[model samples]
Target: MFKDITPNQLFDLKQSKMTIVDVRSPKEFQDATIPGAINMPLFSDEERSVIGTIYKLEGQEAAKDLGLKICAKKLPEYIEAFKQLPQPLTVFCWRGGMRSKTVATVLDLMNIHVTKLSGGIKAYRNWIKEQLDTLPLPELFVLNGCTGSGKTHMLHTLEKEGYPVIELERMASHRGSIFGHIGRKPLNQRTFDLVLGEALLTLKNAPYIVIEGESSRIGKIKIPDRFYQHKEASHQYVIALPIAQRIELILAEYQPEIHHDQFIEAFSIIKRRIHTPVAHRIDEALKNHNYREAIRDLLDYYYDPRYRHTLNYNEEQMTTFKVTSIEDALAKLRAILPALHVF
Candidate 1:
């Protein structure tokens, strides 16, 4: 018999060599899933839709019969896939129901030691939510800068130098702006929570953490209220750089990922702030593959204007680093932090 393991047990399994298999539909796996689980979906999206329709109109028995028929031919393939995996493995479906059980049973009969998640991905999700809700976050230090100031680059530099940092943009899969959606799709809320929970758990013992300043929302995901409140009240370092240098940095970071249509779409977000003629000029620049001109124009006319007026940093909680180069900026920050006591 396959071992029936709880969600807590799944966490323990994660620390071992066992591979976590998600047997839900691929679409379901994509929307949200256990953080390190690999998708080995028992049903494709279309198959799931068909099964759902059958279940709704013809009832459970008919749906089960059809599902069995659909899956019967795939048994050899399933066995081959499972055989390739190490003997000790774990599996789950949406609710730890038939799909995972069938796989686990088949494997167990083949003398493959398989563990089935008792409550499935749903249980793991609940565990993640609870962990996030009660998460003990480190003392957060937000790194603030205007658009094009190379804040993310600075964070990466700090991380390489052994500073404790959690990149909110990486976790959310968006860079935290209108154009942030470029190059990556936003993770759904549940998936975001799982990633965030894992990050917080890893950093719980750190004395302090460096993070980027962000609004309550990053792309489609909302920051947890507690974490956001902590960021709002915590100390912050502001990085200021020459506008020309900033534009160069911004252009370098986004240029590779920019598509003509995407560049146009991003600028269109600020159409209300730009004169129609200026907007047309930006559009023409995009069409001509002159993204630098469009980037500079948008930053000057749109991002800078909006950001400059909105920043209301408290003198007591903020430190400013003004420099012409990234190295100078980082040096200033390093000098400000206590070598032994700071993270």
Candidate 2:
């Protein structure tokens, strides 16, 4: 027999051995879903639209009859797919509606017991909002720096070394810059919230979490207000690197040669903001494939000037680190973890 569980209960089972199956239409699943949940849509986009239109125009009975007809032909395929998934499973739809109920009922009849998400994805979304609003986050150790200072790389390295770290940029799929979206597809707000909520819960018991300093927005996604407030008030470690090293790091990470067209497009967006002479210089450098010169000009004229005014720390709350390389930075940071008593 299948069992029904609330959204809170489902979250409590996140560390357990189970799979979450989203049975909404493909488009619905694509829009947002629980982290790590697999898409096992009950209907294709068109089929769902037809069913919805029938329910609105012809009534529920007609829509049910059509849905039954569609399901009958697909029963064998659905059974095979469900059987292949790792179980015991938890299934959900938009509102714990017909789709999930149908899946649970059918699987049960086949002697495959499963748990149903009581109010489905909609309820889970509400739960996520509540968690973000009220959850007590661990103290944050914010890493602050200008572009190409390797803050993102440091966050991942700290995480690998057993330090709790929240990678906001990775979660948002953006680097929090004008050129942030060049090679990466940004996550919509809903997907960003989903991943962030999961990360917060996963590290709920940690002593503290290390994070890169960022503006409230990463690409188009906005950080939740409560979390951003904590980040603003946290102690910051400012990373200082030489201009030559910063340019080298940027070139290695972005590979402007491979994304030449994208770089041109990004430059177009900021053309009016930059001085005409400097902007023309960058344009000429790009056309001549002198990426290093273009990058230096942008950093010196555009990024560094903008970054200086955004620094939000006092002497008492901030520490500065001057490192020759990423490895040197990592070593210095790791050494401080012991002093901070994080271990």
Candidate 3:
């Protein structure tokens, strides 16, 4: 007889000798699931949708009956699947629902031991929420500066130089500005948090961590409330560069087709930041193919105004470093990053 287990038991077995079988739809598994779990979907996206429609349009009893028919077709395959697994195999659907139990019951009848995650992935999600919602990480040090300061470049430099840096924007396929969407597919919310959690865990054991300054949303996913608070409490630095140096860094970000489209799209994103007349002028410049004017208008009217407006001086420990040229940016970074160069 198979023993049905609670979340705690599943947790322990997962850390040791268990295979976690996620029976959610493929898309659902892609969005999020327990770390190290395999995709053994018991329902396709269409099947799940049909069952849900039945539950809503028909009734629970009818939905369950139809669901049983679907499960019956897959039951023997599921048993064969577990026959090939190592001991302490665990299975779960979205909420430890009937789909998961139906499969577990079959495995039980075959004298194969299986476990069910009580509250299933929902409970695990809540636990992660609890972990990421608290305060005082104290290890955060934010890299702050104007656009084109090469902050992401520096983050890679720092990591290569043997410092831990959380590249949230990279993980989200964003660059953390109105123009952040260039050349990246933003992770769906589930995958974003999963990667974020993994990144945080890696940095937790490090002596220090460097992360770029970004608002809560990297793309669509919000940075955890706790991680934001941690940055607020830690030290800060402004990686300053002269206008000429900034232009060089800025040009590097402009991909001819990709960044151009994104640059044009970004104006709409920050429209509320400028005076209506100024916003209208920028829009006209874009329409007329006046790219230079559009870029200048955006910098003056939007980025500068917004950055200045939101600037704060809390009790953060701050350090300022200025670079007069890209060569200087490289040198300054290299001075602290000899290890990176060697690597």
Candidate 4:
């Protein structure tokens, strides 16, 4: 059912110009799959649904008959699609099931040198699950501090210096909080995974990496569990600054025009948990130019309370380190990430 390529061999071929095909239906392909995989479904969503219903209501034999009919119809179209990628080709479906095997077998007969994923998409997803679960989390050094601490500004500074810093919230089109979304379309999940894959690829041999402290879900996208908990449990570093500097940082992050009722739409996600007094205070502050009061009050009533509740009750024990000044943060970081200081 497979080319008998070793994991390394298949993986090696996967790196460059190779054709990876997903034989699952369009809906499944849209949900998630390996990068660069083209959708050449052996069954469309409705076709698969009908076949499944027959299997449940009639019998396995009847379902197989229905599946064969769908496959025969699409077989030629499927072949044509693979023509676009002339290089080594591979095919996979949910469980290395009949659909993938059939397509793979057809291509193999044509002398395409095709490989079928051993366990199929199930295996790849399982691999992600395992890495997210058991792989000792990456060494996650965080850029943490209060609002004006310029944590994000520092991330850019570090990036310019050549350090690998993950601007996760920025990529997610969210600020990693309730009022995070500014309505731009977040990156598609496929692109998101591609970026994440690249980041993970870069960190493979590193001792540690610096990332911003973020909640599990940024806007609507959730971080993989393994990385989140790893950072949560790892040594934490705080990027600190004076109050005046922090205020400036705050203003820079959330702009004046953005302070209007439109944020209410985003914050609506947490309305149930928002206290009545806090809501009233926010409304009043929004009406007046009491932006400082509005922001601080929200932090005290909503943000601070929630963060405290999480930090205090969470089972993952974390060690704290402070970034007293930009120079100090850079100095401490330089010791661990020497190449980062080059910029």
Candidate 5:
């Protein structure tokens, strides 16, 4: 028998010093998991599948015998890993079931001082969903700007200066654009929520949060309606950069992630809007590695035209700053902080 703690208890304990171990299969761990928990699977993906088949075809007793045999062989490795882990570790599995119990039992016997999560990761996920829906969010301030104005860069700079900022793109692993997935592996919606919730939780007590203005969807993930509603109503500041400078900034930021195929494909998407002839030229330029020209044409003909309406829509309420470079952007941002009172 092993001790088990409720999800609430686990959530509270997370604030303190402790290591959380996830004992689910690797695939499950990768799709979504507790933010800080490490994956220490009791069964590899293939082994879990094999055990599942045995349980379905044979029976529980047969599966148990098989599992025990497999565990016996790997026990030495597991023990060695546990020996190096910080003490007072917490362990969990998909449903606070046998997998986690089996591992926790071993650690306990080794005098590692372990606690098992009651109802497991599933319960923790439920708690996360509830928190996302009901947790009181700090005042959210939107940082609005034309494409490639370096808003994301400014957000990171502000965070480094002790300002409360949340980089949504980083959390979602997508850049919040048509090209968002170019070089990034987008997280599934469940994983997005897990990380977003974790980010929000950390900022719960901040005076306010600075975030980029983005549509509801970022890659495959959808911003929760509640959070999106807050974003819609929050005060916003716009950063302005000259078209040439914007193009240069965009190219520099995406340079490492640029692939000819992907760049051509992205331009193809705007073919119907900007027309095939123009899109064709851009595509050809990208294929030839003329990135600066391609980016310039896309910004001028595609992104700029599409985003122009924002400048006029709420002209009176929005604060706009014209910045020519990163240093200029920071200075302008600092000028607005007094108004935001975040200092």
Candidate 6:
């Protein structure tokens, strides 16, 4: 007989060498799932929909008959696929429902014992939310900077050098700006939470975690209240780069020439916030392919002032570093890492 495991037990099992097989349809798996769980869908989207329709109109018996017929043809393939996976497998579906039950029962009968998640993905999601709500996390070492200051780059470098770091912007697939979504597709809240929970789990015992400072919201995703609270209370490193270097970094990252249409669209959304003449100049520069001038005008008149006005921390509360390049910035940060006891 197969075992049924609760969400908490399954979470602990994640650290062990095991594969989590998601038996939901492809679309459901794609929408949001436990991080690192692989899809082994029990039914195609259309097939699942047909089964649901049958259940609604013709009742349970008819739906089970249809499901059985569908499964019969696919059983051989299922067995072959499960055999190829590593042992000590865990299986789940939407709500520990039919899909996972059928797969688990069949696999058990075949003597390929696999555990079923007690409440499936729904239970896992609830467990994740509960953890995020109540679990204490490591203290944050927030890197604060203006729009083009390469704070994200710093987080990546720190992570590479063995410091515990979380790249929230990267996770969200956004830069947390008006032009943030130009070249990337942002993750929805559910997906963002899934990854965030995974990251928190990985870094729960670190001395402290490094992260770029961000507002509570990044694009369509909101940072969890627990993390946001820690961020607000953390010591901040405010990085300052010369305007020329900042512009170069922004140009390299956004590559307006390659994303010209996206840039144009983003500008249209924020034009009303800029002074009419300045916005006009920016529009003209983009039209003429003068990205440098456009970017400069935006920093001087738009982004810089807005950033200053929204500043949450005073200078006394921050450790400021004015550097000439990213290399210089990294070196400075390295010098202070020991002082922070983050080693």
Which candidate leads in TM-score? 2
Q: What digit string (tens of lDDT, one per residue) describes model 4 on residues 137-202? A: 456777655445566776877877767677887666667666665645565554454446545654
**Winner of 1 and 3 under lDDT:** 1
TM-score of 5: 0.92
Ranking by TM-score: 2, 6, 5, 1, 3, 4
- Model 2 residue runs over 4 Å out of place are 338-343
CA-lDDT, candidates in order: 0.83, 0.90, 0.72, 0.68, 0.82, 0.89
Model 4 alpha-carbon drift over 4 Å, by segment:
1-13, 132-138, 147-175, 181-202, 215-229, 241-262, 269-278, 284-297, 304-336, 340-343
Tens digit per residue, CA lDDT, model 2, 1-343:
7899998889888779679999998898888888889998888999999999999999999999999999999999999999998888899999998999999999999988699999888899888889999889888888998899999889888877778889999999998888898789888999899889988988888878899999999989999999999999999998998889999989988889999999998889998899999999999998888999999999999999998888957889999999888888888888776444344
Deviation (Å) of 273 in candidate 3: 3.7
Query: What stretches of model 3 exceed 4 Å from their correct place?
Result: 1-21, 26-40, 56-62, 74-91, 101-118, 134-136, 188-191, 248-251, 254-256, 259-262, 275-293, 314-316, 324-343
**Model 1 per-residue lDDT tens digits across residues 297-334:** 87777787777775676899988888888888888877
lDDT of 5 at 72: 95
Clashing pairs in model 6, backbone N/Cα/C closer than 3 A:
none
Q: lDDT tens string, model 6, 11-114?
A: 78988967899999999988888878999988999999999999999999999999999999999998899999998899999899898999999999999969
Q: What local lDDT score does residue 185 receive in model 6, on the 0 to 100 scale?
A: 87
In candidate 6, stretches whose alpha carbon ends up further than 4 angstroms from where it belongs are: 338-343
lDDT of 2 at 85: 87
Query: Over the full model, what C-alpha lDDT does candidate 4 score relative to the true structure?
Result: 0.68
The residue pairs found clashing in candidate 3 are: none
Error of 4 at 71 (Å): 2.7
State residue 200's C-alpha deviation in candidate 6, in Å: 1.4
